[model samples]
Target: MTDVEALRQQVAGLMPKVRQDLERLVRIPSISAAGYDAEPVRTSAEATAEILNDAGLAARVIDGEGGHPAVIGSISAPDGAPMVLLYAHHDVQPTGPEELWSTPPFEPTERDGRLFARGAADDKAGVMVHAAAIRAWDGRPPVGVSVFIEGEEEAGSEHLPDLLARYADHLRADAVILADSTNWRVGQPALTTSLRGLVGCTIEVRTLDHAVHSGMYGGPIPDALTALCRTLAALHDERGTVAVPGLKSEPSDPLDLQEDEFRAWAGVRPGVEMIGEGGLTERLWTKPAAYVLAIDAPRTKEAPGQLVPSVRATVGLRVAPGDSAADAVGALVDHLKASVPWGAELTVLDSFSGEPYRV
Candidate 1:
C-alpha cells in the first residue's frame, strides 16, 4: 500500500481512543467568564497538556496575565519536513440557562454522531482531531508541529498576541492554523477568512429621583422609559438601517444564507421573505449588525409597569473590518444622549470593547 493509504488506516484505527479523550476533555467546565469556577478552567488547560504529553509532544502550562493558564505544546518531525503551527483554545463559553439544554452542557454525550457539549463544536473537537491525527504518526509526523492551546479565547484572547510575539522565534512556521473557528454549517469544510468585532455600551435615562405613582403623576412627569424608547427608535431610519454615521459601511462580501436557505435557517414560517437586499453572505459577513443586548431597568417582579423613574439598556454594535471599536461606541453614546424625547437626563457608560481583525 502507498504511504498515504497507510496513514489513513492508522488514523482510522485510533478513532475510538480519540473520541474517548475528546469526551473527557469536554467534561471539564472550563468557563473563563467572571463568577464561574476558575479551577475547572485550570483543569481543562492541564488536561489538554496531558493529552499532548501522552502523544509524546513537549507540553506544559504557561501562566497568563490575569487570565486562565495556557497549554503550550511542541513536537518535531523527522528530518526534511515542513513546520506547521496549530492553535486551539481550551476555555468554553458559559453554559447559559440550563433549561435550554436537552442534557447537561458540561457532560459530553454523543448522539447521532455529534458530540453535545459546550466546547465540543467550538475548539475541543478541533483539539481532539489534531491529537488523533498526530497519534496516527506516533507523535513524530512528516512535518514539525507547534501547538498553542489557550484558556482565555472565550474571554477575548487579549493576552494571546503578546504571548505569540514573545515566543515568535519558537512558534515561527510557514503556516499558522487557528482552529478556534469553523464553517458556517456542518458537512461543508470552510476556512473562515474574516471575523466581525464588537463594541457595546450601557445607556441610562433618568426622569424622577424615585418611583412615582403613575395614576397620580403620569402625564406631568417625564417618563424615563418613554425617553429611552424614543432614543432607541432614533437609532434606525425609515430604511430599517442604522442611523449612526460612520458605523456601517457598504458590505463587500456575502453571508451563507441564500434565499431558500435563509428562509429555513431563520425559521421564517412560510411566506415571509428575508430582510435587507443583496447577497446573504455580504449582509452577515461584511455588513454591520446591531442590537440591544439588555436593559437594566427594574423588571415587573419589583417595579410596577406604571412607574417610569429611570430606564437603562445595553446596546451592542457589530463593526465591519474597517470600522473602529472606540468610534462605534462613541457614536452610539452620542446618538442616545442627543435623541432623548422628553429632555430627560441621560448617561452612557462604555463597556467591553473588541476590535475586529481584518485577517
Candidate 2:
C-alpha cells in the first residue's frame, strides 16, 4: 500500500525548489501573443525542457512547422504499467498594459501566502506541479509519464495538429491529464469537466465614403461607430440572454450554487444584475455567450469631431458543447450580417474557431 503520510511530507519538503523553478519560468516573459518577440518564447521552451530533464525525464525542445517551439519529455513506466500523457502550455497570453499590474509582470512576488506574476498560475504553475510529482517519486513515477508543453496555446494552438501528427508515437498513452484549470475556490478542489469552444472574427462596418464633420453629419447622417455599436447591441435580448438564433444551449447538472455566493465570488457589483437566462452554472458551462473583445477606433483623447467612415470590432462567441465550430462560427457570421443596421456595409475577416471538447 502507498504511504500517504510519507508522500505528503516528501512533497511538502520540495516545494521551495518548485517555487524557485516556477519563478525562473515566470521571469522569461514568454508572451505568445502575435507581434511580440519570439525569442522569449523559445527561451521559455528551452527552460521547460531543462526543468523536465532535471526532474529525470528525457526531454528536448522541438519546433512545430511554422509555429513556435514546444517541449516534449517522457519517462518510461515499469513493466505492465500504463502510459499517461501530461499536458501544459508554457506560452502565456500577452500581458496587456503592464502598468495595471501590482508588480513587474515577470517578477514573482509573494504576499499573503500567494505568488503574483503573469503565467504564475496559468500554467507555469501546472508545469511545476508535474515536475514536483516526478521528484516526489524520486524520478520514477509509477506510470509512464509523457509531458507536452506547447508554446503557442495562448496564440490559438494553430499548429497543434501538425505537432501531434509528427509526434504520434511518442505521445501515445493510456490516459492524458492536462495540468491546467481553476480550482472551485481556495481549499476547494474542482475538476473542470468541459470547456466551451472559441469562435470569433474582426468585423468592419463602413457607413460613409469618407470622414466628414460630425457637426454637419451628426443628426442627418449615421457614423460607422454608431452603426457598429447598434449592431453589437443586437447580439443579446432583453434578459441579456444571447439573441442569436441557431446557437445551442443544453441543461447542465444542478449544483448547490446560490446567487449570493456567486456574486461574492465573482465580484458582481452592487445592483449589477447578472446577465443570461439560466442557472449560473448552466450559463457559465453549457450556454453560449457573446462578447465584444476589442474595437478599432480613434482613442478617446485623440478623437476628432468627425464622422468616422469605418469602424471594426472583434466579436467573440463561446460555442456550447455538441455544437460544431463550423456551425457556431457560421451562425455568428450570419447573425452579425443580418443584424447590421441601416444597410451599412459589413465585412468579416480573420475568422477563427476551436471545437468544443469533452473527456
| TM, every model | 0.86, 0.94
Residue-wise C-alpha lDDT for candidate 2, range 195-258, written one tens digit per residue: 8999998999999999999888788888999999999999999889998899988899977678
Candidate 2 achieves a global lDDT of 0.92
- The positional error of residue 44 in candidate 2, measured at the CA in angstroms, is 1.9
What are the root-mean-square deviations of the candidates from the true structure over C-alphas? 3.1, 1.8
Error of 2 at 344 (Å): 1.2
lDDT for model 1, on a 0 to 1 scale? Answer: 0.80
* Count of clashing pairs, candidate 2: 0
How many steric overlaps does candidate 1 have? Answer: 6
TM-score of 1: 0.86
